[model samples]
Target: MELALPTEILEDSRNKGVVTALYDALSRRDAEAIQQILAPDLEWWFHGPPSHQFLMHLLTGSNKDSSSPEFSFVPHSIAAFGPTVLAEGFDPARSIAWVHAWTVTDGIITQVREYFNTSLTVTRFSAAAGQSDCSIATLHCPSVWESSLPGRVGKSVPGLVLAI
Candidate 1:
């Protein structure tokens, strides 16, 4: 008899892939790939200094050109909890630190919360016990999670705390 992975595990793995591939595409400045991975009406939120909004500037730039990227967000560690994926990196020399919280839907990334030069801690709030029901919106039923981050082209996952 073969043992299959649980649905949540499969989803978590897939979500990790989607977010990882996005970084690869972004590094390559591949507009076509970025467009394919991101949803049209993507939701976004950012916290930190106004000057460190490199990702925002990149995303808002015209999609017409695959110009060289101004900065890189190469996360040292990436973790996926249900539909939410967190990537963190830090640069000590430049004093640059960041974290990205991504929400993926049906293999497409629908939302992202970005942070710069901030510490983040993700807490898990599960539903009442004995709950086995979960909807698409609440993919990981009984489990509501939140974050926290770090680092560089140099890889550092700083100030990111994941609570189970």
Candidate 2:
């Protein structure tokens, strides 16, 4: 049997509301709420080569710098991508941020692949604090899915599969 994809795009109002809730949770540094939206067996990866889990640790309040007295976060965008979602933004005063993520089951966030651009982070921070002229880099997903198929082994199967 083919597995059914589960997703409900609420009315734009409700959708925006959920996104707002997520943003509020992040602003408060509520790790639990953050984790609540992730898949348990998540396999987060980066544009670089680091494991997704490692990136998640850094984003999920498990960092030595997390406890620093000068950290802040602001989530600018959170949009759905089929079964996944992409969020990009930064702490207006720090060099930390992320990119794409996959939601596996039960609203649980599984893999959280982050891309930390220190320069962008600094620029955003300065802009937010009214002390700089830097434009923040927005988050975006590449066109990898449309041109590839995922196998049971999680490898990309090149072109789209034919119905034959």
Candidate 3:
């Protein structure tokens, strides 16, 4: 008998695919495909050096004439937590590491938070038991993924690098 994957697994795969497709489009500089993947009112947040903001240039169609450094986010690993998908990549030759946090809603990316060079971490916050409001819950939030600072020395470590 054939077996079907669980709903959560299926959803995660689909979301991952969406994020992957977006990255593929980005690498190709496919503006049409990127437009199709991103929502009209996409919210973007970027942290790190302004000089390393290659992604912003890509999205806004700037730096077309300049021969700037390229940062292709080829995520070695991707994970999905509900609608949020996290992709991380590093370039040892260039001494660059990046993390892209994409929120996919109904198969379209509505938001993206980009981090580069420094470090990254993803923590999931759940209200403590008997704490009705998370806003008031001064308790500690669980750490989902803690990563080290990228671009340490030499080539990056194999696989995904998570730094807190």
Highest lDDT against the true fold, candidate: 3
Which regions of candidate 3 are displaced past 4 Å? 1-5, 129-140, 148-164
Extract clashing residue pairs from model 2: 37-109, 38-108, 38-109, 39-108, 39-109, 39-110, 42-110, 44-52, 92-125
Better of 1 and 3 by TM-score: 3
- In terms of TM-score, which candidate is stronger, 2 or 3? 3
Question: Candidate 1, after superposition: displacement of residue 82 in Å?
Answer: 0.7
Error of 3 at 54 (Å): 0.6
Q: Estimate the TM-score of every prediction.
A: 0.74, 0.43, 0.79
TM-score of predicted model 2?
0.43
Q: Among all windows of ten consecutive residues in candidate 1, which has the lowest summed lDDT?
A: 143-152
* Residue 156, candidate 2: C-alpha displacement in angstroms: 28
Output the better candidate (1/2) by lDDT.
Answer: 1
Q: What is the lDDT of candidate 1?
A: 0.77
What is the Cα-based lDDT of residue 41 in candidate 2?
61
Clashes of each: 14, 9, 5
The per-model lDDT (C-alpha) reads 0.77, 0.43, 0.78
- Per-residue lDDT for 1-164 in model 3, tens only? 99999998888899999999998999898999999999999999887778888888878868777786666778877888778898878887877777788899999999988887645667666777787666744555666764454547564443333322
The TM-score, computed over Cα atoms with residue i paired to residue i, of candidate 3 is 0.79
